[model samples]
Target: MRGWGPRAAGRRRRLRFDGWIAGLGTASGTRLVVGHWPRSPFGPFSDVMAEHPDGQRVLLAPTRETADFIRRTYSFDAVRVVPVAVRHAGRTWTVTAGPLDLRFTTGRRGPLGLLLRAVPGPLASRPLWSALTDRPARLLMPGVRTRGTAGRGRREWYGARDLHPVVGVTATWQGADLGGLAPVSPPVRFGFGSAPRAPSLTRITTTVEVGAGEEDRAG
Candidate 1:
């Protein structure tokens, strides 16, 4: 794998999405966490687990709605949102997204440089490779830091054992303000475009579902 292909990657090994809730955390730089998974049927702990490479994880919810969604989606016992004001440089940066501090930072440059440098080749390299191989050769190799692949370490906190699928709920939340430093928008509503692509949490039943077969399989 060379880089982020315009098409979504296979396996959904890591639940990465298109856009993220963008805001500055108490940390030094602006942090942007993905707001939705480009693929469907994303699970709790999947999104945050994907970001372990960057050394950051979501710790709180940004709004009441977001909090409720997390609980309903993953059947978490409870959740708490902490608000803090962080000072950077000589100036104080107000928390914009309130308790739900979205994660964002200056990461790596995307595939622009590599894509532009892709060379046109075909007949010349034919002796050694066929058209099938040549096309891939023209493409850039995937970044070393891409979400999931061989050699990448697993996140310390969450995993498949922790995954619990819900019909219309998710663990993601919109971080609104940062310790009164900055103000962020509310969580994406059920039908609103702001919501994740997973599903609409309009009437999520809080009752937990326990499948005896699943429990037996685990045992």
Candidate 2:
């Protein structure tokens, strides 16, 4: 979701967040929705009503600036933002924007950098970096633009559905299966494409990591 506050006198920063909603309709199965939330707080409502070719509706929560933009641009009855139902790990693992379950380290050079430096030669990690950074090459996005954001973390999961055809499968854990895991976020940044240009504050994400012994206890 985008921040709702006084807009910048000049050009305001552009932030895009992506998330999956409960199946928009039975026919469509699941609807993929994106919001110009940073651009409009009222944007979510517009998306919810907007029809997809596949017969799906989008839900969005536009920032305050977005509300004004809608009035200025479309001239419609903008409604208050509706919080979408976020399904994290179901009852086992709750999903929402708060903190991530994993640890993170940031610097001008982070894991990407360390991996690069550890490798030998001038173009040592370039290929690896490109592979990991560019989603399309890895089949996530088309380009690479590495800027600094406030906080960045990734939730590593093993054995999940195959979402993209090009990449085959998102990076996964070795020798682990029979479970589902998702990266938790406070202000979850949808992976792929580019990182946020704005700086974010650090936060702790609390999660329930089920133990092997505990799994035997029936709910």
Candidate 3:
């Protein structure tokens, strides 16, 4: 982790979330990244990061608390606190969040997934390991990063454990069909980095380090 000011480094709290992140783009020019965290400081919850063709970024969270926490950790043009539900069966995932209803299927793990699985989870999730892999992550997946500065004086590390390509998708936004699945074309402008351009599902452990002052509000 990069050092901030002395006071900030001295008084900081680390929070971790372990879960699956699915990124995909629809032919209608809408890109969506769904984070379904089954473990976190605030318990299990899921959030959606969406970017429209017009470049409008929106965050759909399950509650006001989750929405606030996400907004503080990332940038968004609009936010909606709604009932976000995610259900998965085997390789298929179904998601319903406010105006969006999406279903996607994952294929067999690719070469990168195989490589990621070889790394021990404990060693891979370490901040030092994340920093060491940052450059390689960028080279392997353009627009993706392992470590970056988050919002509100916070730094974050993305530790990936597994990955699978998204092979199919059918989605709708506000009842209109979003067309077929496509690559995450223009990359999302939510935080310091975007999801992989190839459209896939990644199992990740996200660690966010926040100063003492921000910690109080983050909770």
Candidate 4:
């Protein structure tokens, strides 16, 4: 999910973010339900509910392109993660989307960079240049802005899901056999799509590796 935060005084950052949300919702054929962080701490889930009074969708957080956030938090495993190389705006990028969130990376980072990607949670933001340099960061915005990364430690299980599709990218499935799970998301099971007539998921994992030139032959 992409995010955009508030901008300088008298700027239309929020409006710009709303436009993005609307566009994404149209493209995805579903509302991009966003988690909202309230200015005041929530007693419980009140923050989320308040932000999404109509439903479970709200304003953007603070991010630019998928590239803005997908650089790290690498190595995710779910039911299935299909990877492919994509070309856009004269650039080649690797896009990977799993159960929790979609990720993008250039695969140029090695040990230290790789370690940062594995930094677990918000803690990944810690030590980031954005969190340090404020003056130069503001130039990226229309006016003054606050920039930084906040991270906790790491956590296991980036996500788990039966099936995931990234529009024009790839498809994947996990323990759910790509939709064999008993119950799908509530909106899906009860709202629009039809459940599988009969889904049988055997808890099994099979790994296949194809060499540089043996892909077709192996298949």
Candidate No. with top lDDT? 3
Measured with C-alpha atoms, the lDDT of residue 176 in candidate 1 is 26
Task: Report the lDDT tens digits of candidate 1 across residue range 1-219.
Answer: 122112222422221122222222221221223232222122221122111213333434444444443433332223454432222222111222333323222222234323322423222222222223323423432111111111112111101001111121112135323221111123222111122222111101011112222211100
Question: What are the Cα lDDT values of the candidates?
Answer: 0.24, 0.23, 0.89, 0.20
Off by over 4 Å in 4: 1-26, 29-90, 99-132, 142-219
> Which model is ahead, 3 or 4, in terms of TM-score?
3
Ranking by lDDT: 3, 1, 2, 4
Compose the digit string of candidate 4's lDDT tens values, residues 26-131. 1222222212112111111100000111233222222322211111211111112122222223212222223223111122333433443454434322223323
Give the per-residue Cα lDDT of candidate 1 at 74. 31
List the candidate numbers ranked by TM-score, top first: 3, 2, 1, 4
> What lDDT score is found at residue 201 in candidate 4?
12
Displacement of residue 143 (Cα, Å) in model 4 is 10
Listed per model in order, the count of residue pairs whose N, CA or C atoms clash below 3 Å is 29, 20, 0, 11
Instruction: Mark the 10 consecutive residues where model 2 has the least summed lDDT.
Output: 159-168
lDDT of 2 at 218: 15
Task: State the lDDT of candidate 2 residue by residue for 12-36, as single tens digits.
Answer: 2222222211111112122122221
Candidate 4 displacement at residue 119 in angstroms? 25
In model 2, the runs with Cα more than 4 Å from the true position are 1-26, 34-51, 54-59, 66-132, 135-219
Instruction: Put down candidate 3 lDDT per residue, 1-219, tens digits, no spaces.
Output: 122212234678777778899999989889999999887766778999999999999999998888988899899999999999999999999999999999999999989999999999998877888999999999988999999999987899999999999999999999999999999999999999999999899999888887777634332
* Root-mean-square deviation per candidate: 16.9, 18.1, 3.9, 21.7
